[model samples]
Target: ITYRLVKEYNLMINILRAEVVANKAGELIMDIEGSEQDIAEAIDFTAHEGIEFRILKSGITLDEERCVHCGACTSVCPSGALTLRRDDWSLVFAPEKCFACELCVKSCPVRAIVAVMHLNGTVLAG
Candidate 1:
């Protein structure tokens, strides 16, 4: 029951620009951007659509300086929503698709995973 959807939640937020549905126990990856208020509103709409979901969190933290680029999160991801890419530049976090389970932070040999908390109390990748 894994699903993925990428939509820009910034421009037209009166309605959801995209939807991802997981009927059973699984993972979902959403790509969207907006303020906490916007996200909350959107999630509410999504809930009415009858899609179950979980959030996976990852980002820079003050406790750890950097991620070791281990693919632990990618390997153990049950829903196939989480992915670790080997980019030439750096580890890119896709907010839209992340479920925020914090598995990457938990299994990291080094403590580099930091939760990105928004001013509205919504957490994102820092």
Candidate 2:
């Protein structure tokens, strides 16, 4: 599928996260870049092959008032979207770098991090 997306649709895919489910199912969150027509065609092609996908704008909200900044969330963040400032030990968030993997949300001891990513008005995470 990756090869076909690259060669046939001329799309560049950057995988952000991947996981295997309880059975044989698998999930992959990726960033796909291509022209509008090519992207549409690629989606159609993949859908016909039984692949499910959603194009979403991703982000998270950090409850600054409730945060303890114990560096727990920062340690679990795979994308470096969550970090502790060296000067003050405060948590710094780079929303643009986040892929909404929900690791920080799960790791936040005070439950300060909440994923804000949605699709069709439905929350996908958090």
Candidate 3:
């Protein structure tokens, strides 16, 4: 499917994270970029092939009230979605780049970062 998307549809894919259980199923977190028509067609093709494609608006939420600005989550964030501001040393979250990996959730001592799965504007269990 990835091969077809690149060769046939001429789309660019950047894989963020992937988890595959042998002979069972796999999940991929990626960023795909291309022309609008090609992208739409690719999505249609994926759906036809029984692939569940979800567009995530937000993957993780940061509670400013609970957060202590310790920046411990930054060490485990693979996508740089969680970072500390240089000027004031405050924590920042970029939800668009997050892949819902849940590393920050476990790393946070203050339980400031919470993982969320959003599909079509609906929040689902992570």
lDDT of each: 0.50, 0.85, 0.87
When 2 and 3 are scored with lDDT, the better candidate is 3
- Top candidate (TM-score): 3
**Tens-digit lDDT track of model 2 for 1-126:** 778988999999988888868768798877788999999999899899998867766678999999998999888889998889999999999888887778888888888888777775677775
How well is each residue in 1-126 modelled by candidate 3, as lDDT tens digits? 888998888899988789979987799877787998998899899999998888754477889999999999999999999999999999999878887678999999999888887767888754
Off by over 4 Å in 1: 1-65, 78-82, 86-90, 119-126
Q: Native-vs-model 1 lDDT?
A: 0.50
lDDT by residue (tens digit), candidate 1, 20-86 = 3656443445445557775665666567667654444334342424665665656654545445555
What candidate 3 gets wrong by more than 4 Å, as runs, is 1-3, 11-37, 46-58
Badly placed stretches (over 4 Å) of model 2 are 1-6, 12-54, 120-126
- Return the clash pairs for model 3, or none: none
TM-score of 1: 0.36
User: 16, model 1: CA deviation in Å?
Assistant: 23
